[model samples]
Target: MPARPPARPVPPAPPPSPRDRLLAEAMRLFGERGVDAVTTREICAAAGVNPGAIHYHFGDKDGLYREVLRLPVAELDRQLAGFDDPGLSLHESIRRFIQPFLFDDGSCNAQLFFREMQAPSPVFMETVAREVGPLFDRFARLLARHAGMEQPNAAIHQLAMGLQAMAHDYSMTRPMLDAFHPELLADDPLLEQTCHRLADWGCALVEFERQRHASR
Candidate 1:
């Protein structure tokens, strides 16, 4: 038999760009500690980049923060890409809408979001309302369809927000889960089960609303 040739060495991966590094570190810092507590210099130091890199890439710390905040919203938007389709079944629509929040990526995005919700800065509130409002409105519209309403009312919006919060708790309350019931986040199967349960609950809520609306 012919001798086997030696395997070639694999090339090393390239280093992250300054911009990428800044965004990553800023996300971590801002997520763990509120945006007000995190400093640009600290982020630059953690990212191993010069402070000016933030200025060069994002114009300023506020710009960098805005970009970082958008990352998770972008992921949710991608997950929700056909969420508003009238053809989708109610169960499937609820599943798709809440699935993104079922798993934690171990990033600070969820933390940051919840933190902003608790005691939001003016800038954070403005950015989040502008970016996230349309997504919430879409979900409310889907809920309205399930409830047989022509359009979403304030009650429908409240229900939509509550359902979303239920999903958000799975990811955002990791520490509490770890301390209380670690099994909930122990595996993919469990997460999927939770997602399905939440979807069922959402359907039930919609049905209740539909019956109530019909009675009027």
Candidate 2:
């Protein structure tokens, strides 16, 4: 009787917006093919939805790509924002930050990240450099801190670029894993292991850089 006095309202199911569908399709296609190779029609075809969806959602191909990349970039932003300056040790700090770039978000929706990594669109690259680039620079500082480099300007920048190169392999070589590094193929359990290992390796690289600087 008490519950009947105030019935709970049913929550509405979230409707998929036209833009959302198009962006999702764009991510899938872009992940499969190089950015230049993915066409609008192809995106529409793969989406199994109307061609106009892209126009309605994003106006143009570049717009669609930006929308797609926003997902991963947003996540990157959130993780970086939560960086605790005091609590994280050097190795822990590097591993925590680097995992998102290389591993799937436990949902396997890593297409947009892979696309950008493969062929870095000028528009997207500029956007990242302005926004996420600072985050990477900050993370590079974390690496530098562990490496004991007081001034990490050039050295840490190189490490940041190296981490990016390593992450791209997950999407760049989806098939070649059949013959080489099959265990390391992203589809298997090995990928998670690989990401952690790479984090350690990245930290090690920074450590070496720190040593060089210290020696000087």
On lDDT, the candidate that comes out on top is 1
Model 2 agreement with the true structure over 1-216: per-residue lDDT tens digits: 455567779999897765666767777777767568988988888777787777777788888877676677786778756553758766566666666565454332465555565567886786777767788778767767777766567868788778866765654564666567665553655466766677778767877887887898
Q: Show where candidate 2 strays beyond 4 Å.
A: 1-12, 29-61, 79-84, 104-118, 167-178, 181-192
RMSD of each: 2.8, 4.8
The superposed Cα distance between candidate 1 and the true structure at residue 179, in angstroms, equals 5.6
The best candidate by TM-score is 1
In model 1, the worst 10-residue window by lDDT is: 181-190
lDDT score, residue 87, model 1? 90
* Model 2, residue pairs in steric clash: none
Which regions of candidate 1 fall more than 4 Å away from where they truly are? 1-11, 174-189
Alpha carbon lDDT of residue 25, candidate 2? 71
For each candidate, give its TM-score against the true structure. 0.85, 0.68
Looking at candidate 2, what is the lDDT of residue 163? 80
What are the lDDT scores of the predictions, listed in order? 0.86, 0.70
